[model samples]
Target: MSMYNEKVIQAFMSPKNVGAMENPDGVGEVGNPRCGDVMKIYLRVRDDRIEDIRFETFGCAAAIATSSTATEMVKGRTIEEALKLTNRDVAEALGGLPPEKIHCSLLAEEGIRAAIEDYRRRRQGLPPLPPRHDAVCHHEIPETGEETRE
Candidate 1:
């Protein structure tokens, strides 16, 4: 069998911030059963910054590793800064994810952006971003378990 990268394996085996929050300021979930990956991200924001982040994921090793590393990356980051984080950053932080599983990292990044947008909407007294327009829709999952486009 091919060997997996040490850091990727480590992060997957011992994920950081791997639990849900008691009362998260924002929560976002994304899944694609066609690919058999699902993730739920939780956040606690303070002064327009992410004070804490956590996640619960059901997927392969790459998905778990990406989510864990992403939670750490977002902590203490302003909403705008966190939104700037991309799947490439998450994969790079994990020493790179396999090409076939790259979507796992993308999912983690999407989850973070979704959570932050939700926080922003709530703070500004606006409704959540519509699923179709948000790029990372979380309001409604399609029957296939993937996000539906408008």
Candidate 2:
């Protein structure tokens, strides 16, 4: 049986917001050396909400799909709301991913958080975070302290 669901396939096949944004309010990048997957998220903020969002993911189908869906989920959301978006939420929105591929969702969550962090830093005149090789799956619980994978 195929591991990917219909929603996953659809998202992967025709991902939305799957490109770089010019003059973005913030940008964040992450990568995984083991799998050689890289992801960069861009944000355009208005007031306290995410006016727009985009992503560039170089990875598997799951990775692309998650990135696409994650951006859609947070496109018009407030920073606080977007910060609360979880990997599980992304997975669930896509009707769930395979056990082994759930990490892709984590990567999406990480990408979102990273981009927002950069935005906050820029707003505060602080330096952006150094590039970190912590993209796909660190397999650690998020700040919400809730387990994401099923």
Candidate 3:
């Protein structure tokens, strides 16, 4: 827990834009079974720019902090700029995360990508993509509750 820096702690303690948006232009949700973390990102786009962004994250402190930072990074930027955001960028903005918790930053990046993809698809009159569940560093349990390794 001490692995978190002051930036991480501050963001976690006072997360920004942490909520759902009504009638959002795009929405993305991603979950990691390994850490039991779930993140949802909503976007309001106007004139090809992200006019507003919000996120809902259910995970550790790192997850929440990363979510907060990621939104701040891309807000008021073009969709293309938002897509440029990487997991490493999120981690660096937070000063850094513990080795085990670095996946949280990845989740934040994925969430942003998902949301942008959704926005683009909608603009093209395409269908929304299925929710994404990317298990990072954890194997999925089968119906029998067993982890099978080939």
Lowest-lDDT window of 10 residues in candidate 3? 141-150
Better of 1 and 2 by lDDT: 2
What TM-score does prediction 2 earn?
Answer: 0.87
Number of backbone collisions per candidate: 0, 0, 0
Pairs of colliding residues, candidate 3? none
Instruction: Show where candidate 3 strays beyond 4 Å.
Output: 135-150
- Report how far off residue 100 is in candidate 3 (Å): 1.0
Candidate 1: list runs displaced more than 4 Å: 1-3, 126-150
Alpha carbon deviation, residue 76, candidate 2 (Å): 0.4
RMSD of 1: 7.7
lDDT of 1 at 1: 22
Tell me the tens digit of each residue's lDDT in model 3 across 1-150.
446778889999999999999999999999865557989999999999999999999898988999999999999999999999997788888876766676678789989999999988999999986778764543222243121111
Candidate 2 Cα errors over 4 Å, as ranges:
135-150
Candidate 3 achieves a global lDDT of: 0.84
Give the Å shift of residue 104 in candidate 1.
0.6
Report, for every candidate in turn, its global Cα lDDT versus the true structure: 0.76, 0.85, 0.84
Residues 27-129 of candidate 1: C-alpha lDDT, one tens digit per residue: 7777654556778888899888899999988788878988999989989999889999987788788776555566777788888988877777777888764
